[model samples]
Target: MQKLTNTIFLLFFVAIGQGQALPNLDSLLKLVPAAKEDSGKVLLYINIGQQYESNHPEIAKQYYREAGALSRKINYPAGIIKYINNYTFVLNMQGQFDSSLLLNKQAVEIARETKDSINLGKALFNTGTSYRVRSDFESAIRYYEEGKKVFERHGSEETQAIANDILQLLYYSLEQFDKAIEYGTAAVTYLRKVQNLPFLATAASNLGISYARKHEYEKAKALFNETYNIGLKIHDLNAQGSSMLNLGDIALQQSRYSELEKYFSKAEKIFLELDAKESLVISYRGLAIYYLFQRNYPVAAKYGEQGLAITNELNLAFEKRKTLETLSSIYIAMQDIEKGEEYLRMSTRVGDSLLSETIQKNTIEIEKKFEAEKKETQIKALTANQKVQQLSIERKNFLNKILLAAGAAVVIISLLAYRNYKQKQKIQEQRIAELETEKKLAATEAVLKGEEQERTRLAKDLHDGLGGMLSGIKYSFSTMKGNLIMTPENARAFERSMDMLDSSIAEMRRVAHNMMPEALVKFGLDTALKDFCNDINQSGALKVTYQSIGLENLSIDQTTAITIYRISQELLNNIMKHAAAKTAIVQLSHSEDTISLTVEDDGKGFDISILNGARGIGWTNIQTRVEYLKGKTDIQSAPQKGTSIHIELKTS
Candidate 1:
């Protein structure tokens, strides 16, 4: 359920909007027909598309494409921008980022022409998703925040809901679990409508994931189950399968293979029926891992092959690679080292290609989102100023009339003087609030720039200063040691020292990589995460398992990744130090909407309530780290029962 809970399920994620409340396309058109003008026709199509986008994306695409065409035909810049916003929603669902970006480009062009603050905000928000899909968190967050400012002006519940949800996701992805939960809780205010049930389920599920990440298994499980209930109510099979998969994943991490088997089976069965290839692949792979954990080698091999076959048939390179990776692991366990190595090679090839493509896409998406947000902010400021000025004149005119009326009806005015005074007072307060909010936006603009500059500085410090120093030290040590020969005992000691030095250097490199990954900066977070996890798990002291659900790629920001790493580091360190645990499990999973990091330890357990509340250094650090990222955390522990931490962040 937590896995199912993120963007599509949590953050205004409508791969297409679900819910029976959505009007049918024909019904929508019949209700809001074209008004002859090109703008009017485009608007009609947009409305129809919203109606059909969930159930019939092809139909939605037709309407949206038509709307885009009509807007261009009429040179109605507003229409063009608005229609494209609608179209982008569909594009995100269809995983057509390229087309989405193209349309978003057109929308940006029109927003510039019309200076429509509202549509500019909507377009900016839509563009954020394009960036998010490409895994460009910085750009995505930038646009989302920019959109929030625009939406704040309009103050529509729906737009505010969207912004709040995006913020929740941004925080979650960053591993600021507490802030993620806090802001996510704030989102519920605007997303109060039951029609937004799917979104609520996602948030709740994400809420659960965050709790789980903190090792609050009970709380996490509860939220997950709640999310599942909503999915079932909506008859959203995709959500249902995803929710179950996460729960199954939890079971797997805890070595509750028996339980995992059941959940995975149910999830796979549903996904198989729906032909949901992505989910099926995830479920089957999870099943294979479960079987392998139980030493049911034959079953593990069977499911691994099955999952691999489907991924290959679909040409889903991502899933295909994952399945192959599992197969390789299975073979290794079965002592078929050569076969294992072969599968590993195939997995690597596919993974490398995916990594390269993902990086390019994420970089481009971030650029587009940044540009779009910059444009949106300027327009929003200008529009806000104009609105204030217009309102000032309207107020003056209204006051003059009110004075004249009051003079003529002094007795009536006196009778309602308190009400009239209160009304005026309320208006004045609202005006002051708006002015203050505008001030904040101005400040935010400066802050955003400052943060980027700071990151640039920090990256330089880590790469040029620390990294160079480490390289120099390593080279010097190597040179001094190259010609030295010694007694066997002395040689062994020297080698051990060298090993420590090497390990320390590698550790520093990992830190530098975290500070600024050339690959992440080059390719994006997904591949970097996969490679990093693989590297960590290869030591064999731990089992780090990961999966992705709906997203072909996750767009995320650098800060978000850093925060996640820090949180994860804290988790792993705690497990290693205190758990006396024989095995550790880590998973990177996402759904149509969200991405999360989960670590479970089958080590010594302590009462989770007491330990988490103890304010120990590790506890505080994990909490602080998650909060800084504006995410949520859950921790679970019990004596002789192991410990598990689940953290889910909402991402759009």
Candidate 2:
């Protein structure tokens, strides 16, 4: 989980020649000679650099160096910053963290001198990412936050989102899941708003892993599925394979053996097809876990060995460490005590080495931070002394006038003090009101979380405990039916009892599903709502006509989507019980910035004015949820007519 998995993000920013085929070196060289302007040559060089970035970092580095030299010769600050950042990107990818950080800092200084906010943000982000790769989370967060503020001020939504996404990953690694979820959710919304498909997919993947770490498996699986589908659409095989491995991990955790096998196998095949050895390491690890779970020691060992071999060949110390741990467990389970001890020792040695490396990086980061703070403090002290000297000079000049203005100043000061007191009073009142509102919102959130947790616990209890017992009872009844010979009347009684038992089992499943629908967990809001409407329609109690636009393709945050679903469910329940509606229409509209829900019924209605006076818990719950979401809601009703409820929520 400490691994950043930021290759997709790097590719998104560096793959400038992604859509078009890369020109040959000969053609690029010909164009370079034909370019009359140094800027044009620099652009060509950068383009060539991007073409070589993924496959040939050394070549890309040289191209970027050439571009930087040309930009410096032309005195193009923006161009200099650009090429330097590009060069730093290649160094960053090559694990040259110290060199990358130095170059990025140089780019930042140049951008600051030129007042290039965009490039400054880019440089800060790259520097932060390098720190993140080195396990210097505090430094990474500091730079990322600074970059985020710069992008926000410049209205660079895509870059701002990328910064936030990286921050989320950092928070996740730091085990601050709540903060991670907050930023992760924000990043996804911002990226989707900008329609940045590749970054959005990566954000979703990172968010899913965060949720998985927090044991939110259902939400995690949904996000992994989303990333997988997005990767398919974008033709990103690495993203696809990574998401497949995540899905397999979720299935493995849930004990869904068949699904686990399917996902792992698919992931392995994709990695093999693409020859993605790094990703293949993860696939092999998943396969090892799968086989270990099945108690197939031999196959687990094989997969574990494969993972180790690849990690060792590629010099992936982290992956090698993980593979060693897995092999240790496998050998221990196989009762090969001597081999197990050897693997355990090897794992310990690798773990210690990684820990020491992290400690060294952290020490360097702390020293850097200390030096920066020291410089800032020294500058501040100098500024303060200068200010004091200036004040002394001003005092000398104003001494003659001070006596004359003192009386007038006293009166003015009195008035100003009164005004300030009044302002403070008003501010205090406003703050009090805000605090009250926040307290209520906090209480509401707590209640909602508690309800969901209870629902999860109850669903699990019903499904695994009571449901299993009932299934056992049913099986016992079948055996009894096969073994017992009875009169027709006795047999009829026995059959009726069996029928009742079956009904109970079905009822239990229905209750559990209602508590926490698997459809909602697995398929998301769109499918869950449609299935809900279908169930109502099939019952012939109230005819439900459901319609949706743009929801199928939408990637809504799971928590938000579930809140909308619950609101819809409550609305339909109200229509069924209170409105006496025979038919209802539920419409969902999804857009870039807003999600709107409409529920209309064709039954006898009441005055909308009475809604506020209504003593129904259902309306209270709906209002609380809508307020919690910071959404707008409207209810319209008339006697002998129909009722309509409309809700609109801002997506971000």
Candidate 3:
């Protein structure tokens, strides 16, 4: 029953308009014949399709088909995309998951080509719902999260609410009940605020299911009643039917047999009238259980068989297994041992088959997702490689031009050799100064290496020795606390001492981690940088945004990673300490033969020439580290404008 729960979530969509009357289906049909052959006609067909989507799916599909044909005839990609997106909802209602997925993917491509992000979000949300229906929960969750972000950015609260509702059901399917409740409750709240009563009822019904699973029956009951009232007020048959089924389920659980029959009978009548087979299965299952409890073996068996048949037609493996189990119990209660045995065996087979199919499908979906990601990565890599090659060619051309000019100047220099003899003395002095500068750089590198070595040793000592001892002491204090009897004041003091020790231990670990991040030593630079930025952001200090690519997979040596990490750390520290920045961005990117580090902050800046006499150790460290790596650093700043520092290092 839980497996079948929320399965029909994809069947209904939140209608867009508020406070506007829906167009009559007959009126829209009449106008379609008189409308001109243009985008307006296409939109009319779409509107007709939506009007029929909830109650008359087949008619809706036909209308969407006509809309699509008209759009293509007019060479209107946007119209085609719109119709396809609407059309997939019908496919979803019919349980045509793979077909719906294909159409949604096509819609995504079309939306992208048109650069329509709102439509793109809709397409992605539809795709995710299709995947959720197919039990590809990983893909479903990824797309839903992405689609939610896009909708939020575009201020499409209606679509966002729809996506959130699907995510709630998806998380419930994945057995992540907390996340299910969170998303489900949020969706209901938002839908209620927007007065989308149909979807608000749906979301509340879904959250009720999740709460029931969590054994929070009081909360579940409240949600179900709320949905039922809203559904009745809106005259939404689908919403009313679903809420009644849920309430009937709750009544059955509570053994309120009279209330159960009343709810189930009403829901069954509604579903049967609408021919909503997907939802009718729920009523059948509830009736089967209700009749079984009343000792009506024949009626219970009949209802179970009906639900089983519908589940089979829908290819709902979990629901089929549930029905089989219910039937087995019914026969067993009736003393039909042979029939019970047969049903039990059928249930077992269905369960095993469902498990196997789920595993296979999940494997295939993961492989497909990874393969697509790999292709995208390769394309990006190729593009970056082409850019690098183009720069190389340009640099070579520039060098050749310079060489030609130098060759022309050589002839003139030969004629002016005596005049250059005086410049040779100055050239010799400059050469000596260059040598001295090189020696100073080497000395700085050695000093930096020593400092790093000392830091490493100190970090190790703190983590392995002091940290361990502190942890042991804290544990000992905790163990001693329960055994010792003291005055109330003494107990309070003892608790304070233990708390202080815990804080001390935490501070020690933080220091050790900063000195030499364990993630940097283990998972490499990207994880370390991300962790660092996440910590800063979590601290409620300056917001630090970090983005890195290829650092994990590029196979840089440890020394290079640490050097680059230290430079970045110094830059972030400078921003936090003196930049007065509200936000900063740290981006580390890598190419085939080069790595670039960029740190920018929206803060008060200084003259670019400040480095000439600047004494700040942070800036000095950044420059020294870059020099040590034989890299170049560019610092751009103005008195009031923000600062940006870019460092590029050769991999070789």
Candidate 4:
């Protein structure tokens, strides 16, 4: 089974309450002609747009555009923000991620400039939705966390609940079931309190999925039943169909095969009537899996093929992969080994393509985030400069007024005042400089955090998704090896092929580990560093001597630990790639509030002054991270002599 299709629609219901009747579109249109070109008219346009949003989005877009133009003409920031929020939401629903993201970012800028916290929070959440739809989970989580904080502080209970709902789904996507349940429970409780049937059903369904993931089957079932009943009350076909599909999944997990056909059949019928191809795909796949378990290959194959057809038509790579796997199982059960293997290969190819796409998208998003931060920092600096100039002008005007009011007696006083003003202005300029540095550091921190999140995501995808597929393929090949009767030459060739497969698996594991070492997360920084050094030593690329002090029983935050680990990792990688190092020493120590790291390598080195001119990404990244920690870096290297680098940071 798949996630509920009603999840996206929850945003719409949250924005426009389902409890109240929608405004009459014709009445709203008639009112538009007589409405003044003011904020009230902007709101009227929005209301009319909302009336058309569900059934006629293109018409809704037109109205929203008119509202936005009017709001701009009136110089109404709130109206403009609202217009962007509503307009981009429709864009997001239409799969125009680029346009939605651009408009949402604009809304954020406008809201920030106006100091409108409520609208700012809403814009942030909407921007996160755009990233989430594009499968940029790292960026999505970052924005979601920011929006959650804003809503908690300034937004209403309903808005806070909506934020929690979005976070729950995001965590669920990350496979962080515990976090998902935490947010989901909060959202469901508030949604139920308000008796918002549409949102409640969706929230409860999501909460149920989290419970189901945690193997709390009873809780999941109860939630699913609640959602189903809510759907019946609201007469929401999408909710009903989704709930039925979820229940079928739960039944399959619990080995209650008898219930599968009933739930799946009902879901299929409802989805077909509603013309929801995505939900229908899940329904078909569920029936296929049910029949596959029943040993009825023909029936299973039929449903699986139906799902595959829809997935292909929709160009849904993820769903297509699942359907292909189901069909492969059906064919294999029917003793059609050739077709089974062919389908299996196709599934693997699709999975690989998805994995590749994910990596490419993450890379692009990281660059985009960095550039966005840079632009924001520049804007802030310019704004600060403008404020300073304005303050100077106001001060000068006041001084001129004092001079004009008095005679020569005011000349001496004016000189003294001007001297004091100059001093204060200097201080203010220094303060602005400090603020600019802080902003730059903040931007660097965001980029580093984004990079780490991307690495973790890629590591998980590689280790869990592709790793399992490769392992299964190896197992299948091994099984076939025993069943085949081959000549000695063919057997030797098979052995070589097996060896190559083993190498590939090992290489993949190595790459995954390097991306994000499990040791770094499970053990403390000291142990993770030690393990990394040991791995390098075993590889024989460099002999790394690791030393630690005052870190045995010390506790460090995850962010700090990750930063330290990456610094060491990058230093070592640079050593191997550029230093031609035979051996290196990595020393880490913590005393009181300060931590120090020293790396010395016995290899050919270049002039350290070269870093002053231009540097590679690795060197730039190291400098950025060190600056982000508010630390100091000292490097000593020249000609063929070895290089030594030391960094120190205050943990407190």
Candidate 5:
């Protein structure tokens, strides 16, 4: 898992335009156990392709490419499907999203043929990670989480753990520290149990970063130290180096410059020894900051230049932005305000792009009740573009027409054109404003309609299926209890029957409560989710912790609450059935216009593909419910990784 991310980040270091080459075909082809005929070769390729998903994705792709060709040659249905996922992962890594998407579809077909959740989740995870790398965090998270469902069902701990790590990072990027920590903590726990030390350290470092960002310095320090120690124990020099680097960052933030410098030096030593210049950027920046604090201008400038050069070579925008900030600080300190401001503007531009990308990635969601590509968004975007074009054209055209006319004609044409120009500008502004309003309205209507539909469906289901069954069970138990005689043996049997009757009654109550969750409407969303989580917590299957922010009665309408409630319930059901999780979190957050809810659990996850075909009907139902609500849900998990379900609703 760690290797996959490292490869992704490191590729920027290797070359910018040139693509990656993977020997997956050879590796997987060898896994076939030397079956001379088509079956042995195809099976070998498929097995190897699965293995390459994490450690050597490029290699995995080649295996799949070859496997697909070989399978088609011999008409091996399963082999063709296996290679399809590998091919998708390869394309995804190379940033060919559209191709990756098409390949995912092909992989899905093959998974259905083989009835394999493992391969199915792989396809979904690949697609998801591609989006994540593209900075479509929300969509990426959605795909990864959906894949988790498949992993949990298919029983792939490695993939599940990997998915959780991705989620932990995604939430962190979103500045949702609590969710980030929750998922990060769960990820570490799983990887450690499975002896995945390298990834474990990565997860710990991430958790530390989350805690640090949240300003829980103590927790962050502990997690970082833990990660550092694990890295040492595992002989993972890279992880150890990164851990120390993060430690330096935390220390610097806490204003412990001494410790910060020490940690950075230690990490720098490792990176320098290994010639990992890209990894050295953080340490260089840290040293630059230290020197700047001490008023050592030349030293500070030197270190800053080094950091900038490395980042530039790597083409890491985020890193480059940081370097620019340091450069701006240096220029300001040197009494060069103009230079400082130039760097400042550059940093600002980069920061905006980075933030925008992160927001689009982490905030937008799939499994939504409404169209993710909403009409309002479309109109506003189109209007904004058209306005720019119109302004440019009008500026030139009006002048041309006025110049071509003579005397009175010129006067009349100029007046009319001027009027037309003003009117067009006015109309464009109005359209923009209206489009903004329409976007909000579209979001609101989607939530309202989706919730109403779910409530109606759940109501009908309770009235018909579970409700009737519970009633029949109660009647049968009641009749049996009434028939018991009063002898000692009869008394014991009667007591047992009563206990059974009581249990049934309790179960029925739970069912009824879940179907409607009256608290959602009466007490509001926060209290209702808490109550629901408490019920689940008592089951001992998992511990559910819930949090809410600005989630008072202001933003939650009946339809919104109900829709969120149903979606939450479906997520819980998925966890119970799939995620071998010991603990979970349900959080609700609201801004003035949006409502976000997340249900995260430390459980065994499954691939998303398997959820529809290989796993069961639960996820499909959950997905349908989310779609009906016109809100959005992001389901993330991998084998043994855990599951994170994110729901974002526009309520205002």
Candidate 6:
């Protein structure tokens, strides 16, 4: 995983050359002779630098420096930002984190002053990369998140996707697989849509690593294969090698020894040919695992030692830990007990150090978030106090004017003046009451919006995060069943547990769907309602018929749609639980300036008088939502009869 970081960084540079065809070195040089000293020439130098960036970074730096100097002479901020962006990339590749950070900071300042949002986003992302390389995960994530917002606002979809890819890799490094998959999925989707093979290959390969970590071997394999094919199409050896290495890792995990040797050997050959030392470390580790699985202790130890040496030289703590563990295993298998124990102790120490570092980084990130939130709260409080003081001063000035005017009046007209003052005070009180009402409405709206947002977030977490984890656990248990020998009683208990697990997963999905239905967000209110009714029908709880009118091409706002859906949902739930209902009807209709919803059920109903007093939470919630929409609700019900509810809201 640590080695894959370098692979992704390399692919990011390769992506710079994508989207358009670049002129050959000779063609660029030929234009240089006739080019004027302007921004165009500055761009030409940067473009030329990009050509040599991957293979000859020193030469790239020379061209980048020339561009920067020329841009400063011409007072071209964009050109200077571009120069710093390209230059620091090469600096990062050469392990010059401090220099890269300094240059990127300068670029950020210039971009900000010049209002170059696109360049600012690039600078922020580059700064994040430098921090990531220095193992400052908290700072790296902050910059990446900030850059993602800027790109979303001002850059293209492709640029935003690129930012997603970078954040995905950073989160993956922190072992946040769910977050990684979320961003990585977005990046892969866009890259594939645009047919950007070079970028797609790398993004897919990186995403596959996250899936693989979650024990989803099949999905991981498919992505790696996609990466390999894309790499072949784009002539990206690094992509090809990284994918092969990842595939080999999957094979090792699944104990597919024959495929392991083939994949690892191919990866090793590619990395060796490309002279990618960091990637080669992974290749060596994979081969060692393959050999160890084959019971060839000497060969396994040989490859493990080679990987350990490179990890030590490069100071890759994560990879070093893994290599040490592998060598320890090989020595133990060969009966070198003392040597095995020595290697085991070293591995433990390395693992402990890595764990400690991760914990410290995470702690720093948490503390930073707390402080930011605390500061924001303080600022809001201060602003509120200032508003209160201003309002108090205005009231005092108004009273003083009233007192002066009353003193100026004659005693004979005192009653008239007093009456006028009393009337004005009454009007002001009415106005204050109206303002208080408006404030309450605003607060309710905020609460509803926040509730919906939280529901959506929770739904995503359940479906993508917890759901995947549960599925993985079930898969592991199923796989273990075939490998284990158990008594009949134990087997029966295991079967029961599996059944319970399946039920739990189904219940989770149901809960998540209720929280936020995917159809509601994607297709719209009509389709989502239809799906909900269909699901109820399938469940055999009650027959629910749904219909919509004047909604074929009409679009409803999300808040209104969700409110209507929830109202209908609550009505149906009550019918299922309390109403001895056999059938129900849900109808939604929209007009030019209004929307209407009607729900009816044939069931034993309660007296309508009961609703005038206290009601259950569900009924109260329905009433609250209707009030929030400034809508009218009509309910008709009687004992031994049916119930019907109608709601109408102004679309205007």
Q: What C-alpha lDDT values do all the predictions have?
A: 0.66, 0.75, 0.77, 0.80, 0.65, 0.79
lDDT of 4 by residue, 1-652 (tens): 2333333233232231223345667888899889999999999988888666644668889999999999999999999888888888667545567888888889889989999999989988888877776667778878888988888898888787777877887887777889989998998999888887767887898888889888899999899899989878766666677789888888877779778899999999987876667667888988987886676879989999999999899898888887887687678667687998899899889978987886676567656765786687668767866886687678667767877777674677667766876786688678767766866676677667767877886787677555754664566567668888999999999999889988888999999998889898888799999999999999999999999999978999988999999999999999999999899999999999999999999999888878897658898888888888989998999878999999999899
1-652 per-residue lDDT for model 3 (tens digits)? 3433455455543322211235787898899768999999988888887777656778888988998999999989878888877787667666677888888889888888988888787778777877777766667878878877878889466776777777787888776899999988888888878787766777888888899878788998898889879867756666677778777776766667667668878889988977888678778878887787676879989998999899889887867776777777777667676887798788778867865765565456545655575566557556755765676566556555666769765556444543544465466557556655665565566566556755775686567545644554455456557678999999999989988988998899999999989899888888888999998999888899899877655787878889999998989888888888899999999988999999999999888886899998778778888888899988899877889999999999
Model 2 CA deviation exceeding 4 Å by range: 1-37, 44-75, 86-95, 264-277, 333-335, 356-652
Query: What local lDDT score does residue 348 receive in model 3, on the 0 to 100 scale?
Result: 72
Model 1 segments more than 4 A misplaced: 1-20, 24-56, 66-82, 193-195, 212-215, 294-296, 313-318, 332-337, 348-652
Between prediction 1 and prediction 3, the one with superior TM-score is 3
Q: What are the per-residue Cα lDDT tens digits for candidate 6 across 1-652?
A: 1333334444443212223346788899789889999999998998888777655667889999999999999999998888888888676555567998888889889989998888888888888877886767778889888888888788888887778888887987776799999999999999988887766876888888889888988998999999889878756576677788778767766768778779878888887876667678888877886786677879989999998999899898877876776677677666676897798789768867866776566556545655575566557556755765676566556656676667554443455545755675577567656655655565567567656866885686567545754664565467568878999999999999999999999999999999999899889999999999999999999999999999998888989999988988998999999999999999999988899999999999889888889668998888888989999988899997899989999988
> Local error of candidate 5 at 456, Å?
37
TM-score of each: 0.51, 0.50, 0.54, 0.63, 0.46, 0.53
Name the regions of candidate 6 deviating beyond 4 angstroms.
1-19, 29-35, 90-99, 128-146, 170-182, 355-652
Q: Per-residue alpha-carbon lDDT of model 5 for 537-589, expressed as tens digits?
A: 88877788889888665655666566677677777877777676778888888
Kindly give the stretch of ten consecutive residues in candidate 1 with the minimal lDDT sum: 1-10
- After TM-score superposition, the amount by which residue 232's alpha carbon in candidate 1 deviates from its true location, in angstroms, is 3.0
Write the candidate numbers in order of decreasing lDDT.
Answer: 4, 6, 3, 2, 1, 5
Looking at model 6, which ten-residue stretch has the lowest summed lDDT? 12-21
lDDT of 4 at 250: 80
Question: Ten consecutive residues with minimal summed lDDT in candidate 2?
Answer: 10-19
TM-score of candidate 5 on Cα atoms, chains taken together: 0.46
Top lDDT hit? 4
Mark the regions of model 3 whose C-alpha exceeds 4 Å error after superposition.
1-4, 10-21, 156-160, 311-316, 363-652
Is candidate 2 or 4 superior in lDDT? 4
